[model samples]
Every structure is written in C-alpha cells, then in structure tokens.
Target: MASSLGKLSGRRVCSVALGSGLPRSRTLGPAGGRICLSALGGTGSAQIRGLGSGSGTGGVGAGGGARRAPWLVAGLAAGLAGVAAAAFHHLAPAEMVPRTEVASSVPDKADDLALRCSSFMTQPVTALSELRARPGDMKTQMELLIMETQSQVCQALAQLDRGATFAVDRWERKEGGGGISCVLQDGHIFEKAGVSVSVVHGVLSEEAEKQMRSRGKKFKTKNGQLPFCAMGVSSVIHPKNPHVPTIHFNYRYFEIEEADGTRQWWFGGGCDLTPTYLNKEDAVHFHQTLKDACDQHDPGFYPKFKKWCDDYFFIKHRGERRGIGGIFFDDLDSPSKEDIFRFVQSCARAFIPSYIPLVKKHCNDPFTPQEKHWQQLRRGRYVEFNLLYDRGTKFGLFTPGSRIESILMSMPLTARWEYMHAPSENSREAEILEVLSHPKDWVH
Candidate 1:
C-alpha cells in the first residue's frame, strides 16, 4: 500500500501527452482559401489572402541561402491564421464555423469518443460556451484529468469499505466552468468523506485584480479586466475510528491571462494526516510515503514542502499545528509546466497508498468513550483552523458562485468544544497534544 503509486491500474486510464505533436507542418485554412507551408518552399511565395491581404516569403531564399528559421515561419503562420480567424469573425460572423461543427465531419466513432470524454461540458450553455471559446484549453483539460482521478480514487476507496460509495453531484457555475462533488457520509469505515473537483473561469474585475496584486501576484491587467482559470481536486476524509486518523489532499492549477495575452500559471497542492491518537509507526509510514513521491521529483521537494505544510496548516491563534505535516506547496511555477503537472499527478496517485494501509490496520481498533471525545475535541480545532485561516476556504468563499457544500466539505461530521478540555499529563492523549504543539519530522 505504498502511496507513491506509479500508473493507475485497471481499464480506466487518464494520461496527458504534453508535447506530442510539434515541429509538424499544419495547414491554416479558412472556408475558401488555404495557406499551405509546403507551397512556401525555397524562393517560392504564396498569396496568403483570406480576411486580409498578406505576402510571405519562403523559409529558403535565393542561392538556397537560409531565410527565416523554420520555427519562426511556423510561428508567423500560426499568428497569421489567428489574426485571419479573428478578422473573419468580426467581418462575417455567420460565415465563421464553430470548431465543433467542423469536428462533426469526422467518423462517428471518433466523434462519439470525443464527445463522450467531454460529457462534463454537457448542458448549461453558458458554461459550455466558455469552454468552446478555447479548444484544447490546458486548464479545462487539467480539470477533466483531476476529476477522472477523483472518481478513480473514490472508487478505489469504496472498494475497501463495501458500504461506502460517493454520492456524485455535477454542477455548473453560471459565470464560467463547472464541477463534480462526491460525498460519502456515515460509511462503515469513514464518518464523512468528500472529494470535489472544480474548473472555474471568470473575468477578474479591477478591484479583484488589485487585491491579487496586493497579495504578490506579478501580473498587470488589460482594459481593467483579467481572465482567470482554476482547476483542482480537493478531498477530506473523517474516519469513524479515531485510531484510523483523518486525512486531507488537494491539488490545483491556476492561470491568468495577462494584458499581452500571455498566460501565467502555477500548480499547488499537498496531502496531510491528522491522527486523533498519535501512532508513531503510522505517522512515519505516512510521511515516508509522501517523501518518496517528493524524492522521485526532487530531493529538496520533501523537505521544502514538508516545512511548508507545517507552517501553512499551523493554527496561530491556538498556537498549535493542525496535525502531523505531510507536504504543501504554492505558487510553484518552477521547472516546466509539464514537469509540475507530472509531479502533481504523482502526489494525487500517492494518496491511496499513503493512507489505506493505515486505515486497514486501525479501522476496527477499539476505543474508549473518552478517546472518542478526545477525537471530537481535536475535530473542533480543525473546524477553527479552516474557518479562520485556511487559504482554500477563504478563496472559495470569495469566488463567485462557488458551491457552499463542497467548500465546507472539510468539516467533520461531529466535533465538540469542552469548557476546559485538557488531557491528563503522561497520558496518550496528552502525547498527541504535545506532538501537535511541536511538529515533528516524521520521515527522518
């Protein structure tokens, strides 16, 4: 049950090919005319006329001398095509065909498969229109990928507990994208568990953009508006048995289009464990599983993210750590977007292996009434931290049209706040509090 899983098993597979088709010639044509790169061979010229008049030289010039770089030519061709399309849309809007209609000409099976995979875009024309506006959009694609993973994770978890199955609810945001929320309540192994996937897009107003600038996002707006896309999978599991421990996992991608039409994006997420009763071996195993995933990408990742999680989840008002830290990171635009995405996928896949074995080991362990009460008290702290300090919760609340149910899904099914809740000194409960006060390097 190692959490750092490789490929997902079984028939369901979700894989992304970041840079598969490149350095290939493509015809950028409108309804009547075609601009063929092949026609622009050595010393040759093609009348690239469509929405507007333009003349382009060949990649190779006279005497077979090198003219423009192949990549540059390709880029110019793409730019020309985009400009032409926009001009055509502006001039003769009805003449411009929707890409979906063009795609409909393909074979039935291929078309069917394409539509089936994008079934999430069905209904709510407002949301679908936003998606259609950007074909093969990275944010939308990532949203679908994470939703598929969420389904797979829930399916796998439900298998472990025969009575546990997520109640799926698909929703659309009027402003932009949509999402799926899966919740399992009063299950055999878990008390309350929620797995939510959302892909939301909207125009950030000048005020919102200013707030973001204040928060240190390095981007300027165009025309007092900024387009933003956010996609993520968030989960929280509150187990029935206190010994089994509670867990949380979240992975997300955020992108904003700047004034120059360049996209600024980043990936952020992490997973952590919260055990009401501190079990040394379980804590070690959990951290080691996540550490293995981090190490696979970079030796420095585990330490950095570990410390980040420790700090981020700290309850400043209460002067305590929420739980034993696992890993957390934000604003990670380093390396390459592809590499960062791959790393996030690795962390998502690692969830089951890291927590399942621990659940299986302790799910049925006996607990006293006092211990159960202790668990409830611990849950109260979780509620406090999320309401007052969790960045995710704050953002969700601010986001227009965010589903309240999914936003508050992290709350435990039951929790209590005693007048003076203090465990006896030298007791196991007291030991947990001690560890919470002083976060430990479980892996080391």
Candidate 2:
C-alpha cells in the first residue's frame, strides 16, 4: 500500500510543483521556485495566505490595500460535513476484487478500447481532402486539414460533455500547432474547458540528431534517431456552479523501432480533478470510485496515487491549491510494450469514476449568476496558471514540430478580468470563496 501510495503521489499530487503552470495559460511564477498566489493581497512573500471563509478576490498588493485574511477552516469543516452527507447518499463502488490484479494481466499493445476511440472520431484529413477536391495546394491542404481535424475533435469533445452533463461552448485555436482546441461552458455541470490532442513526428535537426545518437538511440526501421512520429491526447475541464468544480486527464502511447525491427515502446497518461469547493463526501466518493478501478488492477494501487494526487496540485503562491487535486503522471517506461499498454488502459479506465458523479449530483442543483461569477473569477486564476506556467505548454512550444493548439487545450470557455470585482456578501459566490480561501477536504 505504501509503495502504491508513493507511486500515486509521483503520478498525481506531488507533481503540482511541476504542473502548476496550467492555470492562466501564461507563465506566472519562477520555475521550480516559490511565488505568492494567495488571494489578491498578501504579505508579498512566496507563502500563500489570507484566503477567506467567504468569497475571496482582489485586494491591493502588499503596498497598502486591505489585506485579505487566510482561508477559513470552520466554514470548510461545515461544508465538508455537508459533502460527507451528500456522499453517504450517493452510490459508491464496493470493495470487490477483480479476477486478476497481477501485473501479467497488463497488455503488451495499446488497448483495443483506446485505439477504438479513433474509429469513433472521423478522420479530418481525409474528409477535408475530399471536400476540397478542386482545391489549391499543399499549404491550403494543411490549413484545411488542421481546421477540419480541430472541428472533428471539438465535436467529439462536445458530445462527451453533453453526454456527461457538462457544457463546452467556445473554443478557438491558438494558431501554431497541428492541434484542435475545445472548451465547455455555462452548464449545470461544466463551466470552463481546455482540451486538445496532438500528433507530431519528424526528422531531427542536426543538433538534436547528435544528441540522440550520443544516447545511441536509433531511427525507425533499422536506422538512427533521425526521424520520429508521435501522438497522444491531453485535456482539462473546469465545471461551473463551484459545486461541480474541475477535472483533467490524458492518455498516450509512443514508440521507436530500428531498421532491424528491434523496438522500444512506452505508455503514458493520467486522469485527475480539481474542485474549488471541497466536499469530503464528494472527495471520498470520487476517490473511492477511482480506488475501485485501481483495486481491480491492484488493491495496493489506491493509497499510493491518492496521496500523490493530494500532494501534487498545491499552488504554493497562495498557500492553497487549484482544487482538491486528482492524479497526474507522465513518461511511463514499461517493462514490456504490453505492460505499458495495460498501464495506459488502467489509467483510462479510471476517468469515468473520477468525474461522472460530480456532474450528475450537481448539474441539476440551483445556482445563481452571482455564484457563477465567482466560478468565472476562479476560472481566471485557472487561466493564469495554465498560460503562465504549465510545463506541458512550455515543452510543446519549445519542442520542434510541436502543435501549439493541442498544447493549450486546457483553457476555460469564459473567464473574467475585472479591475476590481468580487461576489456579493452572504451569496453563494461567497460560499465558494469560503472554500478557495481556505482549502478543505469534502470527503474527510
């Protein structure tokens, strides 16, 4: 259990120091260093402080504005109690064990189910080519291909949201990568969404090729690491109505084989959620659902990643976190291609349990515009983190042949930037503020 817990931590929570860059879509803090993210005004130090028991927002900087107070714990405790009540009433998976938890059950290739997702999605390149029968040239073809592919991806994501009770409305490409961006908005469930998947591969530049050869890495088909091709999915979802919160997940497979048919394969992916308002009952429900899936594969797995998820998403700047975090991991070097594939499959299997209930339970709950405004404001912070500091965005941008649109797929549909705005006193928005200002565990 401890080993699994540690791995889960490495996969999810502790990594927030690595993933905190996702919120604003812009880099905000110093890399691998502390910066302040406390509610509006704070002590002008790296420590996150002064979040409140009520809706917390803008305040003057350390210069002279009214200082915001640290988050409220009692309020959180009360809310957590409510959440526990909610979870007690909801359905939760049992402690049943699967027929096999041994690593041997892990598959050697990409799971048929995941590869099948491609089939559900219409291939845009072909559809565009056919539509442009009398078209111009390669550049036009590439442009049309990218646009059409994005459209398809957008539609697919919308369908997923609609089916799950989330709303994803506006999404525009950031223009640069062979990626399609999408967002979910203004729904009983989801509020903001950022999701995109990219496929990139090419011949390495001389400098890059030198680095590859130095590692003795070879190219495809009995050659050198001169050329390569890759693909994968990545995404983030922010729900509206604070009660519904946010979530993120991704799954991918990569490979390299030499001319002699010798090949190396790997699998990488993860799924997690961030709820601004902590509901321990909800957290337990969410965690337990994920735990069931992990147990199906290995009962020992749950404790590891659960703690990891908790530890990872901390926004040290604020002395708080983006939300009650889920799980995160990358670059899985598997013992065998099959094992790598199974690992990817196992992670993918956990997504439904992680988020479905949040939407079902809260989508129909009544919420006011004022409360939504608070959610949007929080979404703004999310935007800040993603744009300013997300490592994935940095990696995709700096890496040659990276698709920018896909790299930035984790953005919200609607966000606010008020010179100085906040929720009304004693409002639902205030309720949300109470949670964000001071972090709470709903399930606990």
Candidate 3:
C-alpha cells in the first residue's frame, strides 16, 4: 500500500510508516514535488521530494517492523511535530512579530548612529544609546544640538588659526550629568577661544532659586527644593589682532519640575560684540547677520532682543554697555516648544556666519601697542561684568555640580586695569567709549 503525503517543494516534511518486521529509515534528495509513505511485505519507504535541489527516493527495511513498528511510529510522530512547528515559524506573517523584537535585532543601525555622534568634539553628556531611545525628547534634542554646534565652531576657528586646535576636556558631576569644554588659547589668530556644552540636572539651591524668582520664575517647590535641568552652548572668541573685535554668544534651555509633578521649561541666550576700536562696518555686518536670523522667526525679535542685549550686558557702576549689542532674550516659553526650538536653532547657527566673517576680514589688519593696551583695558571690564553681573556665571557658580572651568571660559586670556586711566579725548579709543556709553542701531 502507498499513501500520498502531499507536496514538500521548498518546504520541510516528515513521515512514518509500518510494514514487515524490519524497521529502518533513510533521507532523500529532491524528487519531483510529491512525498510518499509506502509499506510492502519486505520494505517500507518515506520519501521527501523537492526538499532542495535534484531528486532521489528513500526507504526503510521491514524485516523487524512487527516488533519495532510501535516505537518507530511514536518517534516519527514526535519528530513530525517538531518539524511542523519550524515550518510554521518560517512561514509566519511579519505582522505577527512584535515591533520591539524587530527593532532590537538591528544593532548595526544603532552602532551607525553612535559612530556619527562620535564626530562631535567629545562624547555627549548623555549616552548615545539613550539619545537614540528617546528621539522625541527635548532634552536629548537640545544636548545633541549644542554638542554639534560646539564641534562646528571649534573646527571653524581652528581652520582660521591654522596652527592650534582646541584642547578637549570631558567632565562629569557626581550629582547628575556632565559636560565637554573645548579651548584654543594663544593661537596665531585667536588670542583665546572657548566653546563649551553642558547637560546638568540637580536640586536648585536657595541662592539659585532666589535668582530664578527674581527673574520672574514662579515654581512650586517640594520641601524648599526644586529639581532642574539645564543645557547650553556658550562661546567667547578674542582675536590676537585688536581690530578683529571680540564676540560672545550663548543659547540655553532650562526645565524645572514642580512639586505637583508639573513641568515648566524656557529658553534663553544672545550674541554680542566688543571691540577696542569701533569699526562701524564690522558692527553693522554683525548686527545685520543677527537681524536676518531673527527676522526668519519674527520681525520684531531683532529690535526687542537687541535692546535686551544692551541692557543685560551693561556695566551698572561704570554707566556703559558691554559691547555693540546683538540680541538677548530669556524666559521664553511662548509660541510653541517646537517653534521656539526652531527659532533658537536659527539663532545658534547664526554665530559662525555673524562673527567668522569679521575675523577673516580683520585678522590680518595692523594694530599698534596702544591699541593692544586698549584691548586689554576693555577685557578688564569684560572680566568685571562677567564675575559680578552675568546671571549665567552667577548661576553656574552657585550650582553644586557645575564645572567651574566652563563657567569662566568666557574670560579673556589677558586684561589690564590702571588707576584713573583714560583714553585721550576724540581718539579712536575714546570714540569707542562714546559708543559704549550710548548704544547705536547698526541696521535700519
């Protein structure tokens, strides 16, 4: 008797049969598309056809089948069950599998993203894997942006200097997160340039909270402590040539989780210029570049933030502004988080375009010892303002886990203070002082 077991082409198959007393089995190569289980007086055969390529037939001897038939049938049944399960798995629909299971199997894709992230000046304060895991998170997005901006600005400055590259420092805070600081000092072109990015989270101290409240922040605290997270990219570049002008810019995001589990977030920052000798054209170009970036988001942003920059970077006791103003804004949570992020991104990207051209234009310009002295005097004032009045500086100093080096990276390499020292009246030095005393609108 011969029993048909159906086609097995391109599929796995198993079968069992009983005949005479003998019991034996053999596997077969591809033989047409049909499979068969046959039994005769002296022989029994089970053939698997089209299992792969080519063709053949297989058989089992039946001499001892009477005694071993029951055991053979039981063992073959178990083997057939296993083979059926494997076939079901191989032919199962893709939708039947869980999405996470599919994603977890592709580690090569995750590694590729990590490799791309490594191109930054240093590794991110947050792990790349975590960043990949939370693509929609604002915190992750902000950290990645600042790190990328830091790397770009450092590379741009190094290209212009052609002699020195930034020295990288990666540090961590015991309390929560960490940061990367890149500095290029005493280069052929840049006197001192520092660009840093930090992602830190911890409980806000009393002084820090007081400062925040003073700035109009209202937070619900738990037991007099507020949990906060801050991340930003800040840079100050002072060129070797006094004519090149100094530039400073910082953009940041902050979040505070209230006692009730509610969260409040905001963005803040700006860019400004300080010069030993006032070059009207350079000032105009710098302000115009910033204006263009702001105009893309809101036309009124330039004028409003420009005034804020003037007011924020002021030397109160000296009764003068810090530099030719660009733009400054704080406590911004308006329009929409996405809209504000795009606006901030636009402004951050404007740094290189706004300032690098001025460097290229004035880096090779001639400068006298007197002008250098004037530059040093201006730097002295820069130090005074940052140490005494800069809110970011003060906040960083007050924060327990903040990196002190990054907080003070904005300070110039050298500065000078002389008793009752004054620039000669109506000279280029005094002219800049006059502008500093009275801020001007470089663009219409």
Candidate 4:
C-alpha cells in the first residue's frame, strides 16, 4: 500500500542506535544539510554535532566537557521527540499520515505531486487516479496544467477582492469528459469574474469543422465527422471600478483523430484587456508583461500575436476593437508538441503579474454615477464582440452537451446599450473610443 506524510515543517529527524551502544540521531534540514547528535552511554552526556555531505565524523560537540546524569539525557531526548511529534500533529490533517507509519514509509515524488494536485480548488474533471496512471499522455498533461492554472488565477483574484470567494461547479458532459467552473459575482472589488477549465471529448459538428477548416486546419473525415478532445483554462474578470480594466485569457489544447486513424493536434489562446476609461500606463504595463513572456520563448511571438489579438477581438460592425490588444494565436502545432506546451505554460503564468497590479492601483479609484453608466455601456461592447466574434464562445455553444453557464461565463454581469450613444468629443470616454477605433501598439 502507498501512503503520504503530513506537512513536516523545518527538518525531519530520524534516530538509530550505533553498534557501539551509543544512540545516534540525524536530522535532515530543509536545504539537505544534516545534524547528528550522539550521547556517550557511560557519561550520559550528549554531543550535539553537525555533519556535512559525505562526512565520516561529526564536528566538535558543543559543551564537550559538560557532564550530565543519565536520567536527564533520557528526559531531554524524550522531550525533544515529543515536541517534534506534537508539531506534526497540529500542522496537518489527522488522516494525512499516521504516526505509526512515519518511520516505515516516506512519500515518493509521485505521491508528493499528487498531493499538490489534490489541493486544487475543486476536484479535477479527470480522476486523480487516471491522471497519475497516464502521466506520459499529452491529454493528461494538458488537463493538469489547465487545472493548476485555473486554481492559481482564482486564488489570486479572490485575494484581490478580499471580501468574496468563488463559487465552484464541477460538471460532467453526458457525451464524455467534464469541467470545473468558478465564479465570483457582485463583489466589492469585482462585479463579475469567472475562471473555468474543461476537458471535453466529442465528435466535431459541421459548423465547428468548417470554422476550423477556415483557420487552415486540414482534416480527413469519415462520414463527415471527426472525433476530438479539447482542454483549456479560460477566464474573464470584470472589476467594479471603471478605472480598473477588465481582463480575459484562455489557453487550450485541441486534438482530432482522422478517418485513417491518424491524429492531429494544436494549441491556442491569449490574454487581453478592456478598460472603460483609457489608462496608457495600465495598457503599457499589461502589454509589456505579455511581451516579456513571449520574448523568453520567441521574440517574433509578441508582435505576431498582438496583431492577431487586435484583429480577432474586433467588433467589426462597430468599426472598433474589443480592447487594447494583448497576444492571441491559434492552430499552433509548430515546433513540436512539447515545445508548444512549454510556451503555452509560460504565457499562462504571465497572467498574474500582467493584470494584478492594475487592479490594486485602481480598485479604489473614485468615479461618479455617470462614469458608472459609461462603464456599463462599454461592457455592452465587450458583450458584442464575445457573442458575435469570439471563436471560443461559438465553439462552446456548438459543442454537444456543453455547459451553457460556463460557456457564457465570459459576459459581464451588467451592461447597457443606448442607441446612438457616443461619448463627447475630447472626453475621457472619447479618448478610449479613439484608441479602440485605431488600435495602438502599447509595447513598441
């Protein structure tokens, strides 16, 4: 049977008796250093000493000449052991590790990783047992990454809000696979925020197939249908303060098995911002963070994807963009699966540093009722782009047995559409509209 240990703070201590009848103890420090303590049985005096890597002998013992009674030495060792035991007991759940089993078993590396995954906000769509069993599979690896990303983003947003926590929903599709959706609504800091991860498998619909084909995806189909699996983490955060920009991000992996039993896959997603009121500093910071992440992988990525985002999120009918752009890419199966996965992971990790500071800086900024109305109207534009032009939204809606709530979680809670609405010339609202109409290159 396999087992795990509780959270052991500081160092781990183990005791053994030497052949010379002296009881020796070794403590493993956090950084892999070791301390060895031995007591001379006859004198009942203990020598507290340190040991370096591969060292045969201990260092000079502290208080070498001091003499102690046998009973005292015994009592001291027993007391220290008791304190260590108590510390372990109070720190973790009682069922995490049994006291009787600690000496006989230590958690292996696999168990440690599994324990971390188990700490996610909600149970993973794929069973933990299956994830551990198929560690080498790309599908399993992508699922784990998305789950980890979802938990991290959700936790970060909750901390910023300080008053409201996310409500989690775990649902399984009747066809195959499932997902976890976390939403925080009507909070003091955020009006609506959703972070969701899904692992869904099904046959692609003709509409979806056509959409993919339009993007240059080549597929060999039997009976005009292709079986596919898709997994990703997506988030849209709508902050209450108009000054704080709303942010959206998604990173996903897609695979389809062709009629000839051949398989093809790709990765896609990006992060962008939509602010009601323009802030050059905020826009620059957000784009710069994303650029740095992209630069680490490839210098060409930021420029290419930034323009793609600007074009992809455009509200074509309105003749303007959804927001000041970030990076967006799709049908990315190049450079090898492993390489692309790593690049996607890097982009996913960049979300926090890119957006959190803007929130902290403007979450408390003052605004009037008119400004609030302007914010709502701006959100109406956000709604327009997502529903009408967002590929992910369309794909989700077209999928069989898709969760409607999770698919629409990207929409802001409140929005207004006033016909013939336009900001006054040279007003702050007009400033943002100008930039949206003609996108700016914030990073260079």
Error of 2 at 368 (Å): 3.3
* lDDT measured at residue 197 in model 3 versus the true structure, 0 to 100: 76
Against the true structure, candidate 3 reaches a TM-score of 0.75
Candidate 4 wrongly placed segments (more than 4 Å)? 1-110
In candidate 2, what are the lDDT values of residues 228-276, reduced to their tens digit? 4344555566655555767776655444545666655444455666665
Candidate 3 clashing pairs? Answer: 21-63, 21-64, 21-65, 21-66, 22-62, 22-63, 22-64, 22-65, 30-55
lDDT of each: 0.62, 0.41, 0.67, 0.67
Q: Which stretches of candidate 3 lie over 4 Å from their true place?
A: 1-112
Better of 1 and 4 by lDDT: 4
TM-scores of all models? 0.71, 0.52, 0.75, 0.75
lDDT of 4 at 28: 32
Candidate 1 lDDT over residue span 154-202, tens digit each: 7655655543334444445666765555555555566677676766678
lDDT of 3 by residue, 3-106 (tens): 00000011112232211113334332144222223321112343211111111111111211111110111112221112221122222111111112111212
Model 2 weakest 10-residue run by lDDT: 6-15
List where candidate 1 sits over 4 angstroms from the true fold: 1-137, 205-211
Error of 2 at 395 (Å): 1.3
Residue range with the least summed lDDT across 10 consecutive positions in model 3? 1-10
Model 3, residue 265: what's the lDDT? 94
